[model samples]
Target chain A: MIVTEKQQLKMLSSAEMQLLHEGSCSLLSRVGVKVTHAGIAALLLASGAQCKGDRIMLPQDMVKNALAQSARIIQFEAPDPAYSFTVNGPENQVKFGTGGQALYVVQRTSNGWVRKSAGTDDLKQIIVLCNQLKQVDFITRPVECDLPDEQKDVAKAAVFRRYCSKPINLANLVKLARLAEVLEIIGNRAHLSFIISLVSSPLVMDSSAGDKFVAIVQKDIPVAISSCPQGGSTAPFSEVGELLQLNAELLFGFVLANVVRPGAKVLYRGIPITANLYSDASPRWCQPDSIRRVALAAQLCRFYNLPCCGTAGVSDQAVPSAQGISEKVLSWVYEAACGGQYINSALGMLEQVMSVSYYQYVIDDIALGIVKEKFSKAQSLAISQLALSAALEVLGCFGIEPDEKMEAELSARIRHIENGLEPYNETYIEDQLAVIEKAVNKSSSTVFMKAARKGLREGYLYKGARLDASLDLAAVAERLESSEGLGT
Target chain B: MNKDELLEKLEHSVVMGHLDADDEGYDGSMEGTPGTLELLEQALEAGIEPQKLIESFRVAMEKVGNLFASEEYNLADMLASAECVGEAMEIIESKLQVGNSSNKGKFLIATVEGDLHDIGKNIVATMLKGAGYQVKDLGINVPAQAIMQEIREFKPDFVGLSALLTSTMIEMEHVVRLIKEDSFPDLKLFIGGAPTSQAFADKIGADHYCRDVMDAMNKLEQVSNVS
Candidate 1:
């Protein structure tokens, strides 16, 4: 899937993006990221990063140099050569893939929707089901194996090799000691990729993930350095603040990857979602605020011309419904239009990445097909207009009729996505940095949550009507009934 | 100001979630004002009894808890208030007699081995501290041996284990086994994190499973009352 030149949506102005880039550089130089791995810290220190105790502070030149040295285009090879794809930084190409470390499998039974713990069997069935889905360009491990830690990597890799013929993304390497065996089981590194959250939120380098990332990047394997900072908790609640922090985290990974091995194939995956402060403080993955921030992350990745691994379509709704589908349609459209090169977690995720549904996979395939069709015919159409039209059409197909209120709510969402919520100035960025620094120094998000009080009062999060009508899953059921190896 | 007024200001500052003179308080506009710490120091200098100050903390925190329960205050507000109380307790702890400590109980918490995530653990720790518990956070990725050693030395009244990943959840079970294998009587074990549940806690022999910080506090309070 490719987002054409005409369909590309630029949410942030060029000046705003430049300011964000400079803000990231300033944050890297001033506050710095806490690197627990001594060897990796030494590598970064030798490469012009200043050492401030445990933190490794990279200079602006070091960040720019690392960005220059990183590979701009990455080739994702599949077991079947025809399914392989290339993600070029300068192009508007987009690829959708299944993703999540979902814990439960949601199935609609005669009684009601029941969620069962997902295991190795669910992993195999998901892979088989995704293999037949037309829109899933790649397969990121959606569920973890029930095996012990030592055997998990190898077991998951073996399952992928057996059931999935598309590009395989064995999401994370659980144990570094088993990496060799897992690679051997796959037999070809070209068909395999991985995602590592190398840096935790608020600029803390995860020591375990750091080790795995070093080992994987040393082998020249394609990996995405992901950083998911939930605003109002792990990150600043403001949009500008969260993006600045998220970008700095991912840029830290880029610098580390280049330091370990220059030109290491790494994708920039930044998911700056928000926490629902109104309730349980749980992450709102597909909400309007999150959709806007995630789309802006994709846009910023394109601004750096880095290979982007975007996250979209992870619904906050626990069960499959009209609301979930509506959220997914809007998320996929905005993410792709805003320049996500290789989007992961784009299908079958539900319950805010806690669970996945087999029926939702078919529904997403059909919904994504509708989105792509809208994009193909979207010549000279504004992305917001196209998104609204596509979402309405998809919902109508699933027995949903959008009333005027729903349309008004969606328009408000689009307007929010199109506008900047906070000022992108040096003073504002400094304040945001101070908030992040306070949280990091205290080793908690208390400062962030405190700062979020104002944002919440001012309605930083979107309050819109939910399209909560039940989704007609008749077509989805029919498609799943015909699909092979689902074990239904 | 008089002792009564000073104590009143201290309580108000805490309810406002103000920490020090630099804190912005709950609404981001109270940075220049004297905050909880300043007001607490003032009350102490004014010859207010440490026990009275402890009573004020309890009152202010109860108000914060009510606000949080009613959804008038979010986690950040509650956490900020908790942080204020936590910092204030550090100051007030020195003035009290040996047996007159304000701590409700001692808590030892950690994110189990192989888990680097700590937001949940940090929240629980801060809340426990704010709720008048003497908390020793062992931090993330702490091995069972270190936890056991800490148990021997610290002798906490409660132990809370946290793990975000399922892999580390297994480590939680392992840590629980090691703790149970030891002869630590009257030390209740609690498990929490995104992956943990009541079923998991029951299977792993933990005394309780905390869904969140409030649940941890409420459950600990309930157990305290019962015992």
Candidate 2:
């Protein structure tokens, strides 16, 4: 049963794939990404990555050697082995990467923000949302940050007493690293993540030094890879060239990460889409072509058989709107289709990894479902062929010849209808709303919310890993207590 | 010295990061070199206008920002570049004040409340400020009211906001609404970072969704011209 569909589409030859892979490697080694970590350079040099001063030139052999030791796949287990990014939970298995969502606060009164002091209740709510989300397979975590903002200036040293007790970005880095360290600390916990940047785009040796908090975890969270690319203003005005050059640096980063961790779960976050045609106003993300190129980038990583990350669900919009959807949907499909193991970026994320929308989590979760759905296997072999045979025997293929029967059977045997991100394409969104005779005369969602709130208050049921001894939890508690007064 | 020669000198100064008393050589450590007034004057003397000289400096600074944004360079290098750029700009500022005024426009940008990751916001701001725009950088965790108050006080033509976390992005909707309600309705609202898009901008009624700094400036200039 030959469907003969897309047969002549000329699938990329293994040679072509190899070429792309080599190109990435060469780009990385020859141009090299920027380096912020001294440890990374030492490790790369130790592992035979040709280093000239600060910049490292890693040959393809190094990349292949490092990748050979990479863990092919991993499964995230719940409640305990929190270190793995996996798909081995009780119900949902969709793991989430860090989402770069835009637009954090909604305004309250004339000049006020509707902020709920991020606390236990808020943490619990996030957990609940993660659990309830059908799209989320496993939680991407060390989910901790955002303390309440106080109007009165609190003492800098009294950070622990004045504001809601929680770690902010760089502050949270150490706490999250500890969380990572404890969670099934796999790969190289001793080495720092390899960081490489572009020569042209290079600031200097050891230029960017953030994310060092993860250093305490002993797991080399490889970073400092130059997204050094010239879209229009800086480099050639070609998307493909931009991708190749960027991928080259990123691939070098991969080698660096691998050199340090030796096939560790390196995050291959792609940063493409520079300014368009000499003008900064026409951002490449706003263009459809840019989205497709990013998608191709996912496949590019796959061609190298390396774990991939970055640039999906990210949009060029200032807020959640029409332009956001088109960009995200296009790029997300590329990510899902290209088999990216880990990726993030919110539907309403904007301005190049700066912000994300609040509702985007829920909305993007649904969008994530579309990506997760691609991994879903639909097999008709599970359905009794005999049962279908009887129904087919009664009617037959209208006017099909005997030879055509085999083709039809083959088509039916393995038919894949590409449901391109139509969330709930088959069924309308619904809940178990009907009342039964045994049910009570009334029902209340608020009551359920109340019970959940109580459990959160007790602290026995749920409490996320706390960090930052420098902050106060009192204000957060008070704010959580009066959250109902906050959200409209 | 003319514009080309001045640009070359300024480029060297920016790269080298200092100047001698007679403008002979770099004065500080190899990496710790900071920009100075002499460099700007030399750049101006080369006939490169103050604006172009600053643009050259910005070009150099953006490379640093790009490295930071992509995780190529670490935070220290990034902060150092910021320091270098700041010093360089002081020279640029003084030189401009001596003769002309360079204000691209009153551009207001901030990292919205309930979010604290400043790398992206800071990077965008650096590029904007580099381009000679009067960037009123409202530091991280800024409330909408604070933004409006600044917008009122500053009378900025553009309001820029950034967020880093997903849960916090929900807060941006209010910021947008506040600006609309309290500030100028016709205000050219531009936003960016990860999780923002053209569609999201339309959804939230933002004037523009910028991906990169070049895009931000280009769109800013187009949507609402700065006189």
Candidate 3:
């Protein structure tokens, strides 16, 4: 049975939400969004938007009409039906999944945990772990594989599609050359998955992201339009101002996608990141403001009846320490309780979402189980649960004796409830770890290993082919053979 | 404000990331006060030495950099301070006579090919310029041929290559190899970036690895004294 939670926390009042939406609509109709791509600009212009060069001023009514045409509930298709889910709408449930583009992986050592650049082998391990864990509902590109700069995204998608049967959230396919291969990998499962297109915050749509977005949407695949407006840096410092800017950016994409193909399946994702005033870092999962902003984003998504996607379970701590675990759990509770339907980075992330930890993956599963259990609806009490006769017999208030068969039935039922509540303990976590270990030891999925073995060759060929130059492949192969393993 | 007061305000402006007299975006308290660039020009107009004016900007940047290191200031703060320095440098560049401060050294800097990041490169360039080095910034994604061409014409005492992307750092090796093979074989090559390390620098045959702008300046001083 799937676990679901209904949000009781209203971070924003109705009037405030209306004002925020109106402010965004004003920003759209007034300041306008900068569309860097010529084709996107033309499309918007043709669709009744006022375009002067790169800036496209979208009419408020046009935006509202576009939103009206969009799907309230879009199905997130997966390779298997078990992993399939729906996002947006009132029926959306809080689901945990892996988020991506991490450059490094954390590994345990005698001293402590050390971080190393993630490569193809780490990518495989990430997918395999996500697949083995019943907790992870879907998979995004877990870690950016250390492959040739030109082919990493395409190669990662290919490898992930082959091994992981869950739904995938494709990272921004910036390179046009890799699009065809990625599309082929997605094939008929377009509904089961979606590609992401990011907008440079403070109201700028990158031309490359724009082109890739159109390309994906044109193929009938759902697209997630995500914008991360960093407070005090990219957007306004005030929370209200930041949300307004974030909403405006997301609405711009919604209008653009709908203009291209009306009623296109789009997930309105807002990542309202907070900038650390003392540090140069844009902390992905930090304090009061980040969680508050997340809740507010969900509230806003509820206003639009769209599936809310945001970041949670992130940490500034490098390792799985008290600070990391506390921050992850806090963000998880707030995001889940406040109606975040598709919470990104909810599992297996550490170091401010820069690195993925294998151990942290198991720990997060247990944490997720606890949150689900705590937030799950209370079971209704029945006459059997009252246990009036058993209570009277135990208290010696009645002359009648308790039935042994009924007593045994109650004990069995009590045991089932106790078992359900005990998944968060260390023993259960260890069991999940052992399952992952067994899966890895089995080596049933050799696709990632195959990719790792070909890393040097593919990198060399891609770069060499670009240069129109030839290398002594035999010599390079000998060097690769003698080297230490990738992602070590 | 007096000359000393003006100079102190210049330092405060950068620390606060205030650009001009009316620049009120960051801190409202800084509004209506003369910013770094305005005070710098005022100092120059008040018969202060161009060297002294440049020194004030340098001291402000030092404070900003320290704040950055201590987590008291962020990237936006550093960037805003850099913008103030850039504006002041442009103002002071016209007043200063050439060859007055050329004795320290001359340096050419560029982000290696296929890498578009130049935040670190720009900061280093500004710091080196303030440190009395004649800096030629080739901007981002500069190919090896451009560096070679500039080297042939500019004849810099040192070349600093920056690459933020690990994949593009390979291009730095090519640049170093080509520059070493050129006629100016003694031209010192220094490398720095997010992915660059002392080990990578040594393997790429660079003369030095700069952990940050201050490190680069310290190594530059050492090179100047030795040469």
Which number leads on lDDT?
1
| Per-residue alpha-carbon lDDT of candidate 1 for residues B1-227, written as tens digits (9 for 90 to 100) | 88888888889999999999888888889999999988887887788887898889899999999999998888888888988988888777765543526467889999998887777888888888888889999998898999999999998999999998877888999999999999688999999887788989999999999988888889999987887
Ranking by lDDT: 1, 3, 2
Candidate 1: chain B TM-score equals 0.96
Residue A388 lDDT in candidate 3: 24
Residues B1-227 of candidate 2 have per-residue lDDT tens digits of 65676566656554443433322222224333324446565556656666676677777666655654574543323333443455566566675574323356668888888564444565557556555566778876688789878988888878888874554566777899888877485568888865566776888888888876557766876765643
lDDT of 2 by residue, A265-332 (tens): 55455555544322222345534445444545655655555555435666655443333443454455
By TM-score, the better pick of 1 and 3 is: 1
List per-candidate RMSD values in Å.
Answer: 1.8, 20.7, 16.5
Tens digits of per-residue lDDT, candidate 1, A1-488, equal: 77888788888889989999999998999989999788889888888899888988999998998899999989999998889999998999899999999989999899989999999999999999988999999999999998877888989999998888899999999989999999999998999899999888889998889999999999999999999999988899999999999999999999999989999899999999998877657789999899999999999999999999999999998888888988998899999999898999999999998899998899999999999988887777889899899988898889889888878877887777777667888889888888888888887765677789889878888878877787788888999989898884
Better of 1 and 2 by TM-score: 1
Candidate 3 regions exceeding 4 Å error are: A1-6, A149-154, A282-284, A377-488, B1-18, B24-27, B59-83, B95-227
- State the RMSD for candidate 2: 20.7
DockQ of each: 0.59, 0.05, 0.17
**Candidate 2 chain A weakest lDDT stretch, 10 residues:** A431-440
lDDT of every model, 2 decimals: 0.89, 0.44, 0.65
Number of colliding residue pairs in each model: 0, 89, 2
Better of 1 and 2 by DockQ: 1
Q: What tier of docking accuracy does candidate 2 attain?
A: incorrect
Give candidate 3's iRMS in Å, 1 decimal.
19.1
